[model samples]
Target: MESPFWDMMGMLGIYAPLALGAIGSILGCSAGGQAACGAMLDVESGYGRLVGLSALPSSQTIYGIVVMLSLNRTIEIESAPGLFAIGSLCGVALLFSGWFQGKCCASAIHATKSKPEIFGLSAAPAAIVEGFAVFAFIFALILAGSLPAATGGV
Candidate 1:
């Protein structure tokens, strides 16, 4: 028989993606937003671009929401391990991706502040980070499909 701890773990797993992703987004956005605010002081224009760049990390939260929804079902002991593994790992991937993407955005913002010509190029690194987040999101959805659905009413 399964322990109550494992059952709780399954429940935790269901929500982990959304929680972790939001935390990551919060951290990432703060980092980029702070840099953008500083950049605003240094630059005369292009405020819109800086603001837009800072918002890029927010996508991770949306991805997290999707993953959470995909993983949602009545938790069963038999499926608990899979749920915990896939959900937690995907959440970690999203968390790091969002954090790093924000750092990239900050660097890009700083660089562009001094040299406006590189604005487009500076966003490349952030985009690359975003690509990785997308990979995690896609795989989580795929794996979530393999888990057994709720067998009866919760």
Candidate 2:
């Protein structure tokens, strides 16, 4: 029988990816949105760009969803360890990536607001953070693929 701790871990693993991703998205979006609101108060011509930049942090949530889908499986005693390790690690990676990306987006918004010309350069940080999120997503998929299919057979 699975220990109570393993069972709890398995339960958390099932949801960690999606939950962490959503938390990060919420935090990141709020940060970027605040920056966008401030920038809108200061600028009039590039609202579109500002809004786009502010949304850069949302990618993490999508990545999280993908990981969650890939990690989905029946939580059995033998499957619990892999699920907990992979799901939680991926979740943490995506969570931090989104939050940092949002900070980058906020920075980009402010810089673009002041200069109006360095828009592309300003977005580079967020793009780099996105790269890290992508890395986590890819690795999680790769690892998840290696796990044996949970076949509760006789």
Candidate 3:
């Protein structure tokens, strides 16, 4: 019989992606939102754009959700290691990407506040950070397919 500890680890692995991703998104959004609010005080007519830019980091949470769903399965001793490896690593990637993306968005917002002409260009760095998150998401999905399936009658 499998130990309870392995089962618990498997469960933690299953949920880690979503939990970490959400935490990252929260941090990213908070940073960007604060910048947006500060910029709003300085700018007169582009509050909408600033607010929208602040939301750029939220996509990492969505990627996390997709990864969590992809990794979802019955806990088994055979699958636990794979689950933990893929989910935790993917979650870490997402966490960093979201956090950095938010910082990028904040910089963009601050820069654009003074030079609205560069608004679109300023978003490029944030988009690049998002690309890294997508890479992690895709790799997680691909690797998740290789985990051993749970045995019936557990």
Report the number of the highest-lDDT candidate. 1
Top TM-score prediction, candidate number: 3
Is candidate 1 or 2 superior in TM-score? 1
Model 3 scores worst on lDDT over the 10 consecutive residues at 145-154
- The candidate with the higher lDDT, 2 or 3, is 3
| Collision count for each candidate, in order | 0, 0, 0
State the displacement of the C-alpha of residue 136, model 3, in Å, after optimal TM-score superposition: 0.3
For model 2 the TM-score comes to: 0.93
Q: Estimate every model's Cα lDDT from 0 to 1.
A: 0.90, 0.85, 0.90
Looking at model 1, the pairs that clash are: none
Candidate 1 lands at a TM-score of 0.95
> CA RMSD for every model?
1.6, 2.2, 1.8
Q: What digit string (tens of lDDT, one per residue) describes model 2 on residues 3-88?
A: 88887887677678888987888888888999999999999788988888888888888888888888777767887888899999
Q: Where does candidate 3 stray beyond 4 Å?
A: 152-154
